[model samples]
Each structure stands twice: as C-alpha cells, then as structure tokens.
Target: MGQDYKEIAIKLFKQGKFDLAKISFNIAFNETPSDELLAFIELCDMAKDSPSDALTLFEIYFDPANDDSAQSINEIIDIMQSSVQQSTMEIESQNAITYADFKNLLNQNDFRTLFESILFSTRIIITHKDELFELVNFLVDHGFLDIGLKYLEGSAKMFMGDERMELMLEKIRGKDENSLK
Candidate 1:
C-alpha cells in the first residue's frame, strides 16, 4: 500500500482506533508483507494488549537464514514467557492454547524450536475423540503437518473428515498460526 494508507493507519493507531488500524494493516498485508508494517502491527497488537496475535506476526517476519531471525525468536520467547496467561503450562480449553510460535525455529538455526514451542505451551489431554482428533489434526497441519498426518494414518490413525475433525480444521483455519502463510 502507499504511504497514504500507512500514514492513515498510524493516525488511527495513535487515535486509539485500533480496529481501523488493523483494517489498514490488512490492506498493506494483502498487497505485500512488509517487515516494517509487521513491526507496526506488533506494536498495535501490543497497544491493544493482544500479544497473542503479535506472536503470530513474528512467524511471518522471521526467515531462519536472516541474521535477525534468532534474535526475533528470542524476543518471542521473552514475550510469550512474560504473558500472564501463558506463563504457566496450563490453559483450560484448547482456545487458550498458545500456538507453537516457531517461525524463528523454522529459520535453520533453531532445529528444535518446534519441540520447544510444543513443550512451552499447554497441550490438552485427548479425551473426547472428536476434540482429540481436531487437536491432533491442528498439530499436524500447523505444528507438525507431516508427523500429524502420519499419526492420523498410522495405528493411532483416526479417519479424517469426521465431523469432529472438520470442525477443528475450520477453527484452526481461521487462526493464522503463522502470520505469513
């Protein structure tokens, strides 16, 4: 987007028109991902006290090979660890789930980022097979797609497209686990 829109977005954020600022950012993002704009969005979300979403933004900004990705991941670690909601290893429903914020790990340096991500957040027990399936599938598609699928197709495999699985997929789809893609 042009500087005009970005200017407007800044104005909106400054004026506390957070939702509008988000819309403006959306316009910029749809046109092209801007690391700078991503930073602004992070600031905006932080201004709004929604660091959870900020966590998503870093996933897009970071590319492992870049010299800054690891630093960014460390920043993420500080942010997530600081959040009161996620400080402890427990969140009630899966909704409270802190996604595996691993884009920085995807950066080649943090080979075990995913594992660390999973370990850091809450992982609900697999009770009702339906919710269990959805969680598993989410882990597959976002956290560990190949492994998740393998688990699905393997001995512990449950049929995909089960009504339960589909709902979870829908919810997960709406969540931009990774800000970039």
Candidate 2:
C-alpha cells in the first residue's frame, strides 16, 4: 500500500503536480517511514516555497549509481525551471517597479528598513549579469555593504572565474574596509 502511494507520488511529482505529490508522499511516508520518502516530502515542500532550493535538494537526493537518475534529474530541472520562469513573470507583472524607482527607494534614508522589507518579501531572480552587478552596486552605495558582499560572493559561485564577478568582489571588499574606518 505504501509502495502504491509512493508510485503515485512519483508520477504526480514528475507531472509537476507538487501539492498532490506532497500529499501522496506524506501518505507513503506515514505508511513506510522510509528516508527516501521523507526526503521526497521535504523536496515537495521546498518546491512549493523555493524551487531553486528544491533543485539543490534534488541534486543531493540524486543517485549517481542509478542509470536513469540523470534523466530524472534533468526532467526535474526542466520542470522546476519552467515553474520558476512562470513565477518570475507573475511577480514582475505584479510589482512592475522600474530600475529608477528601485534606485530611488534605495537612496532614501530609511532605505535599510525598506530594503530589508523588500528583500525578505520578494524573490529577486536576477537573469542578467548587468542587473546583478547593478543591484550589488546599489546595495553598496546605499550602505548595505554586508548584503552587497554576500550577494557578490553568492554570485561568484554561479559565475566562477568571471573577471567581472572577481572585480565586484574586490570592489565590495575595498568598500567594506573603508567603511570600517
């Protein structure tokens, strides 16, 4: 019976019906209590809240020994990426804040509070390198040195060995040091 539920969950998950998949996975987990099913449950929850983080969890759960796992992983990636694209489009349409308005907000004296509010409330997905650079610069210029540095450092992992990223890291570090004086 647990195996039946697990099978159903996997099918639903592959179909990108994550909410239904989660319910099925939860049922399977209650019946079988297996680590794999638990992981899948967690993955489904992460997928609901954060698809990007779900991809990381999916990679961790991937079985390199299984020949079919690679295909499954790719399929999951495609599904999650499409989901993220849809979400990004929705959020952009809803917010529709221009770069100039964003910068204006950042330049305000209460920008720290506003910035933190926006950062926590929004799922900013930078699709372009220039936008990423510009965002980091804005953060730095507005005294959000720590956040800007963290952003640049996180980006460095995705864009390894990119000279621009390296330069940004160095620039942020210099600013950080000078600010400490």
Candidate 3:
C-alpha cells in the first residue's frame, strides 16, 4: 500500500468518514492485509465511535453462504452483537415508528437496500438454526417476505434435520402461481 493511501484511510477513519475509509482501506488492504493493518482496523471498530458501521463491517466479513475467510464467524458475530448493544441510534425515532412501522419500513425500497446489505454480511451467522429462525421469523412477522425468503434460502443449508424441505415443498405444491404474481 502507498503511504498516501494509508494516510487517507487513517484520516478518514479519524474523521468518522467510515464509507470513505472503507473504500480506502479496501484498496490499501488489497495490497497488504497485513496483521498491522487488520489490527488497526479492528481497533478502529472497537473504538465504538461508529456502532452501525462497525456492525455492518463485521456482517460483511462473516457471510454465512461463503466460508472462505480465515476468521471465524462466531468471533465476527460477537463483535457485531457488541456493536448492536452499544448502538446509540434509536430503532424507533421516526414518527409513528412502531413494530408495525418497522415492518412497513422493511418492505420499503430503501429499506430493502439496507436489508440486502446486512443480509450479505450476516449470511454466515444467520444460517444457524437459532439465529436464522429468529431472524426470518422476525422479518416474517414484520411482513418482509423478501427478507424472509433470503434468510430461508441461507438457513436451508444448515437446517438438515427432518424432511422439512419435503414438507415445505408440499405446502407450496398447490399454490396458484398466477395469484402469487
């Protein structure tokens, strides 16, 4: 990595310029994902200055459908949960933001963009029966069927217990495709 890139990454991180820092770091890390750089990034994450950014980064690092990384998903999940617990943003700060409000929000186009971002990141951790069940059930209850389908597809890989797939296949067997459309 060039000295200028490192300087830019650090400056952006310090300025709370996370997305920019992430872009810079990706370029820099591409050249050298050395322990020093990785540790520095982790330090910035644990600094708790940007809870949502940290959580989102951790989510991308441990995707459920992709087990190609050297880092353990559990460790990443631990970090994400920590960030979530420490997040300062209100989950219901918008006007009339109830559970129903969030449900509707999840279905919105903008929210789907955010949802897809998280899905890409947390796919790995979300595949566990307990986690996947909780996540999918939450989205389903909130009327986010698109999110539910995404989680269900990922969780199916880990859900190898009974003939549940068979049962599910049966349930959808007689459904009217035209009506669904």
State each model's C-alpha RMSD to the native. 15.9, 14.3, 16.9
35 Cα displacement, candidate 2 (Å): 47
lDDT (tens digit, per residue) of candidate 1 on 1-181: 4566777886787566776887787678667776666656655656454434653544443555557764664565566456645544445435334333333334554434545556546353332344446445646455555445443455233444456555555545454455447
- True-structure lDDT of candidate 3: 0.53
lDDT of 3 by residue, 1-181 (tens): 4556767976776675665766676677778766435644664555334445555554455468767554544455466567555432343232222333344556765654645555543322321244445545555544565656665675565465536544443333323343377
Superposition-based RMSD of candidate 2 using all C-alpha atoms, in angstroms: 14.3
Better by lDDT, candidate 2 or 1: 2
In terms of TM-score, which candidate is stronger, 1 or 2? Answer: 2
Clashes by residue pair, model 2? none
User: What's the true lDDT of residue 63 in model 1?
Assistant: 53
As a TM-score, model 1 comes out at: 0.31
| lDDT values for all models | 0.54, 0.72, 0.53
Q: Which lDDT tens digits does candidate 2 get at residues 1-181?
A: 9999998987787666788999999999898896567667767865654556775656554557657754565565566568667866776777545455666776774766777777765645555556778888778878888888888877676666568887777778888889889
Q: Order the numbered candidates by lDDT, best leading.
A: 2, 1, 3
